[model samples]
Target: MLSFARAEGAMGAFSASGTLAVMLDRNAAVILVNEPAERLFGRDLWVTGRHLACADKNATDALRRAFHVLLRNPTPPAMLNPVPLPRLGGRPLLAYPTRLPRITTKAHPVR
Candidate 1:
């Protein structure tokens, strides 16, 4: 599992390398995104707090299913092929989901 710091480092490398990349938390929320990704998605604003499912309304169901499968499986899949990104007429992009180290807290009062 990738730690938060490691994930951030990875994102930096990816950004420097001009690779389109995004890091999502276990809950499938956008945690980090690179420049190429921003251009590809056509947005310059920070998307860290947004959920991936809501990022692309056209691919909501597909994104939800993909995230669900990744979350449920112990191992990451080779790739989530042909993920439709919210772009000009919805372009398909290959997606890879990496598991991040689960953050545990003591406050377990409510769900």
Candidate 2:
């Protein structure tokens, strides 16, 4: 499981790399997301009941496949290519799934 400390580290890596990050669970539900990622949601993309969603039908279909690959990949590479999130306007966002370390951190309970 990706601990909160690892999540923070992942977020830092994402920021340094100029990429927005979204972490999903095995069932494809949104576990957590960085601020930059939440801002990416507007017209083309948004969270539909804790899952990433797309306004465009084609993009939605594409995201479904990407999510499957992301969730079910058995090998270590996780994903060989970044999943392309198509937007109605502006450049498409490339999503890369990463595994965070297991180190834990104390924090307030989820309210």
Candidate 3:
């Protein structure tokens, strides 16, 4: 498993592997997003002012719930159950959230 000892390493690996990864803050605002994910913007997904969103109400609800799953659950979920991305054509991509370890930024240290 890739570690976020440094965000660069994990983000780089995800980019190299062609995996779409979005790092979200407690408020569901995006902190970072991979290249593959950028393609999703203005299509199925939207990142307005650092907050990720979708056009479909159901999809948006699912996405929000998925994020909360990570926040509320003591144990990490094996998967976010693969929520489907909206599509105009082709198979929809599945979106899932993975919790990062409580990484302490220089400004905030973990106890």
lDDT per residue (tens digit) for residues 1-111 in model 3: 122446767777899999888877677778778888888787667887776777676877787888888877778675668777676665766787778766555555769
TM-score of 2: 0.69
RMSD of each: 7.1, 6.0, 4.7
Instruction: Give the better candidate number (1 or 2) by TM-score.
Output: 2
lDDT of 1 by residue, 1-111 (tens): 345667777778888987778777767778777777777554412343386543556566676678777777777674565555554454456555544454433445766
In terms of lDDT, model 2 sits at: 0.71
**Which whole-number lDDT from 0 to 100 does residue 90 have in model 2?**
79
List candidate 3 segments past 4 Å from native. Answer: 1-5, 105-111
Models ranked on lDDT: 3, 2, 1
lDDT of 3: 0.75
Q: Could you give me the TM-score of model 3 versus the true structure?
A: 0.76
Regions of model 1 farther than 4 Å from truth: 41-49, 53-58, 89-111
Superior by lDDT: candidate 2 or candidate 3? 3
lDDT of 1 at 13: 84
Worst 10 residues of 2 by lDDT: 97-106
Question: Per-prediction count of colliding residue pairs?
Answer: 0, 0, 0
Number of the top lDDT candidate:
3
Clashing pairs in 1: none
lDDT of 2 by residue, 1-109 (tens): 4475676777778777877788776788887778878788888788888888876777666776777765576654535366677777878776665544334656779
